[model samples]
Target chain A: MEKSDEALMLQLQTGDLLSFDTLVKRWEKPLLNYCYRMVNDVALAEDLRQEVFLRIYRSTKTYRPTAQFSTWMYRIATNLCLDILAKQRRRKETPIDAYLESESDGFDERLIDPSGAPDAVVLKKEIKDRVRSALARLPENQRVVVTLRHYNDMKFHEIAEILECPISTVKSRMAAGLERLSKMLSEQE
Target chain B: MDCRFFREQIVSESYDQLDADAKKSLKAHLQTCRECEQFQVSLNETQQTLDQWEEVDSPIDIEALHDVIQPKPLSLPPQLPAWRWLAWGVAACLILTLSLSVLAWIGVDVKWADRGLTLRIGQESVPEITEQELVRLLQAERHATQVEIVKQLQGALDEFSKQLQVHLEERQKQADAQLVLIYQGLQSQRVQDLGFIRQELQHLAGATEAEFLETQRAFEFILASHVSEIQKNMK
Candidate 1:
């Protein structure tokens, strides 16, 4: 079994650069997926994921092992996404998807299941696209909660900690998000 | 559990989020209620669809990350030539001696006595070109220096007082602005709350009116039916 992420972070805290590499390798993809879903842009997601690791390394000296590694990491990533959204709001930029749609060079292919037969692959791709599109349509608050719950498989209490909201609020948001997602998917059908 | 309770628990139950007791109750209710069972099926389907949306294999550049985390090799300072080293040494010695000489000139006596080199203030009074002229010049310079110092202090005091006043005014303005903002926020919140309360009251009143009208219509219909029944019986 691999060393746990907290252990790796502890090693990093002790100035073990190799352990930092190990952490980046482990967290980069999930963080990338999270950023992509949050921002709905491939290039921006990749950039934000890179920044998340950089910030983690920068803060390793002050990092305490009080919280779980995943919680800390997710909180960092979540803050970065929120910061980017705030900047976008300030600049009054076009919607991320509007740009993404124009640059649509198979951005959704990141979720493709490669081992399936051609027809099965196509159908799977369609389902993934529909689900993702519906996810994209949710308000940012609902989107973040739903994605954390579903994509990251975080518990409601963990999400509450990350969001700094009450567990009831997280549950209500999740239910509301899921209900809206249900309606959106049904409409697509 | 009633259908409403089961409906509320459906999402949690489907995701195994409910406690064992709640789960048991919800499951028992599910067995009895067709609508809730259908809701559970749909919620599970929604969760499965969400699960199917997996992340793709997008490779991160580990090399780039290495560049960020890798420790940089330490570089040694370049070796100086002998003459350059000599120059630096001479410069450092000169600066030290210059500072020492200036200190000695400032009334500290430096001497080579019988025992060794000694440093002291030997004379209580120094002979100038003219003692009177020197005394007058010294007194004049001292008075000028004192006046300049007093002026500088007063200027600093005035500037500081102005700055303090400005700072206090700014702080007071900020506090007042914050108070106004808070008051406005509370006012708007009160308006929103009142609006919501009024809407709820209106909705309740409408419902009560509808119920009263419906009851009155039902009473009238009953009276008409009873009269017709009696008339037919008497006939």
Candidate 2:
């Protein structure tokens, strides 16, 4: 049995370090993963994650849990990401791995199983490459929406709450995102 | 009334955010229309590709988050000279005194709120270098801002690297290869540009004429490949 995020967050409000730790344990991976995708830079993503936690820590006393815990957390993360996006708007964008021919992000080729099984090795590498490329095609909003709905298993309404948009907008972003990917995949072959 | 309603419903069905009455009418029409039936397949395929991309698994790490929460020790070592400690104590007092004075000058009611959102004020109060940044931002057609949108792309790239691992895992969903490729390309550009920009922020901000020229050249590269370019050209 797990303590609900609401319960954990309430404990955090009292300056309970352990409770905050529990909340962190529950959210860290997903939060980190979300930040990573949202910012697309490892350092910045990590920085953003820390920033989010710092925010949560500060707001803990003020947190009212009016919405779902995940929703609130995401709201903070999204706002931070959006601000970063706004700032970045002033400069030129360079896609990661554009200059380097290496595989994207930080999973070097070693992620492939070295079992000496050629096909399996090739299969894993191919999967990695394809997944990387598929993610790249999505708009930031679409990418976040897809990740939230499909990966985190959030409902459209919940995603709406998280994104602070109308539920219809979340659905719209999701639909368009999916539509865009489906068209791209069709062309890839 | 007949075909147009059906067509609108067909597209709207993909979102399913439609109201129940609309859904019911749309479903009824979809059941009867051959053209709509075919259209549904395409829509479903598109929906499926997006869903699948989310399912694909990627390598991700979770514990790295622990390091983010622990507050660093801010205390000085015990062996510091008495004078140094006294100086530090005096400096801390003066800083606190000055900050409080400033807050009092601003008024406590507003000061507390401002404290929570000082960055917003900073942005508002600060001046942009000349009118160049604004001019560049305005001239962009939601497409041409890439040259001046360095920070945005850098943040995007940073996000890509952080999320790439998760992307591997979330990608377990079944998807069409071509759709994935284009999605990847767009995402890659976002990620790459972000990385490029992050590495060059201050450099771009105070860029020499030569550097600005270099940035403009990079924008040309993006202009060559942006999806919006295709959209604009087609129009």
Candidate 3:
């Protein structure tokens, strides 16, 4: 049987290096995707993801099993993202999509449309770009709420814990974010 | 029964956050309220639209993280492979035997019958000296000196590599520590920013509270006065 995260964590705390490897393998992709959407930059997201695991490895000795391992992991990852976003805010940098087009060719090529029709392929690409742009335009809190809700499939309470906010606030942000996204998608269509 | 309550439930129900009681109420309301029913349809459509945008699944480069979690180096010196050491010892023995044979061939009395080297020169013994024996001794001394020099160089190289690795690790740790410090500072600043916003909202709420009540009272008085004036004019 696969070990539980808590079990792996316990093993890691006892200095079993393999447990750390196992944990990293299990979480690296999901955490990378989470950070990508959070920061909207692939390279920055990977850096943040690495930082998340580095922090986890360092803290394993003091890690408490009181909460689910995912909760703690998300808290660390989201906080790192928020810090990056805050710094961007201070710098007054433009949104990622502004320059994303220059880099989009390399990335979007990976997401190939299975259908061979040129029209369908183009349509899919347009919708994908629109969704990303709309998501990028959302305020940070709402963007995070929707991303956690849809992409991570985290529970409202879990998201609340990660964001250090109330469940109602999470739901509120989700509602507003969804409504805006729906409107944006419709307009694009 | 009200559309407002049902509207709130629509979004929550879509998220699977609605309680059974609230869900039942919303379902009943949906059966009668065309507007809210349309809203439900739109919300579901929105969700479907979102579902179309699949998340990009990119692999993480884990080598960076792996470096941090990797175990420290063992302190013991690396030993040469047993086979290689055995080969070196055999070659050295062969060289020593070859030199002894050369001494015997050169007409000097040489004995190496397991008690180690012994030699005689010109039958006077000459303190047990032979020219080939002297040459053999010199060659053996040179080989041993070369081996010692190689070993010392190898040790120095190992030490240099270890120190380089340690310095690289120290630099990485320092960079990580600096990043963490910056992250903490940003987090605190975010908290302060939130607190400041909350305080401003509270202040706005206080300032608006009396104005809201006073406006309500004034509006009611105006309606009453207007109604009486209309009645008088009608009479």
Candidate 4:
């Protein structure tokens, strides 16, 4: 049976290096996806993912089993993502154009299935691009909530824990995020 | 009931987070209110659209992360020269002899025989050093020297490894930047190719339309001439 994340973490705390490796392998993709949606930049998202694991490894000695391992891990990732976003804000960097440019830069080709019909492929790519752009336009808090709840499939309460806010705040953010996304997607249509 | 509360409930219900009691309440509200029902439908549609943004595979692998995180093991330094060890041994012997000589001068009797050195101070005899004891002392000194050499080597190795890691990371960043530039160039070229194709298609379409019009005009004239010829024959 696969070890639970907390179990693995506990083992890691006891100096079992393999447990850390397993944890990294297990969480790498989810964390990468989360960071990618959070920042909307592939390379930056990758760097953030690496940093999250590095932080986790360094903090292994202090990691307690009191909370779910995923919660702690995501909290680290969320903070790192927020820090990067805050830095971008300080620099007055507008990422909307960058997001659009990346979409057109053949990066979306990874998301497209080549075996599909040409017309269907094109249509799918267009819709995906629109969704990504609409997502990027969301406010940061709402975006984080939506990405965590919707994309990561975390429970609303779990999201609250990760964000260190009340569950109501998380739910309201989710509602607002969905509302905005619906409006923006309609406008795009 | 205020629709705002039901709207939030609708969002929760869309995600299947609503309790059974809250779900029933939301359903009853949705049955009566068109706006809440429409809100749920829109939220669901938005979710379905968001699903198109599929998860991408992480470009980085675990090994790369491991390499960055795992501290490199300390390496043993190169072997010390035999001459250096000889010089150290000689210096140690000289210091020991000088200390014994000083002790002898301070009203102490020192005797050197085949067994080892013996000392007597005021008719009280000190323990003699046996061959085994002397050999053990020399071995201990050599071991300590070896440990110190190993420690110095480890420190140097650690420094080199750190510098190498920084250099590697810098190079990796440079390569990543170059790759991004190349990718952007390709994207722009693709866009330009698409624009050129679009312009060519428009030109071809215009020429096709002009030829079509010319053919239609000629056909009309030929039909008119045929009709006139027929009328004349009938007259």
**Isolated chain A TM-score, each model:** 0.90, 0.85, 0.93, 0.96
Instruction: Please give, for residues B180-211, the per-residue lDDT of candidate 2 as tens digits.
Output: 88899999999999998887985767768778
What does candidate 2's lDDT look like per residue over A22-141, in tens digits? 777677768766775566555576678778888988788788978898888888888898788667655655654451234343543435556659986765555444544665557778
Candidate 3 docking quality: incorrect, acceptable, medium or high: acceptable
Where model 3 places Cα greater than 4 Å from the true spot, the runs are B1-5, B71-235
DockQ of each: 0.29, 0.08, 0.30, 0.45
Tens digits of per-residue lDDT, candidate 4, A110-154, equal 878989999999899889788888888899999999998889888
Residues A1-189 of candidate 1 have per-residue lDDT tens digits of 899988998998888888987888788788888988888777888888888888888899898889888888899889999899889979989876575465344766645557769999888877877787888888889999988888887888898999999987887787778888888888887
- lDDT score at residue B226, model 3, on the 0-100 scale: 100
lDDT of 1 at A42: 73
- lDDT tens digits by residue: candidate 4, B119-152: 7786766799999999999999999999999999
| Runs in model 4 lying further than 4 Å from the true structure | B73-77, B80-235
Q: Tens digits of per-residue lDDT for model 1 on B94-160?
A: 9989987896778787778999988786466755578888899999999999999999999999999
- For candidate 2, the per-residue lDDT at A23 reads 77
Error of 1 at A12 (Å): 1.3
Give residue A25's error in model 4 in angstroms: 1.2
Best by TM-score: 4
iRMSD computed for candidate 2: 5.3
Best by lDDT: 4
Query: lDDT score, residue B104, model 1?
Result: 76
On residues B74-189, what C-alpha lDDT tens digit does candidate 3 reach at each position?
A: 78988899999999999999998998788777867876778897777656634777999999999999999999999999999999999999999999999999999999999999
List the candidate 1 regions with Cα displacement exceeding 4 Å.
A109-118, B1-8, B31-35, B69-235
Tens digits of per-residue lDDT, candidate 3, A15-56, equal: 887898898889887898888887877778888988899899
Could you tell me every candidate's TM-score relative to the true structure?
0.58, 0.51, 0.59, 0.63
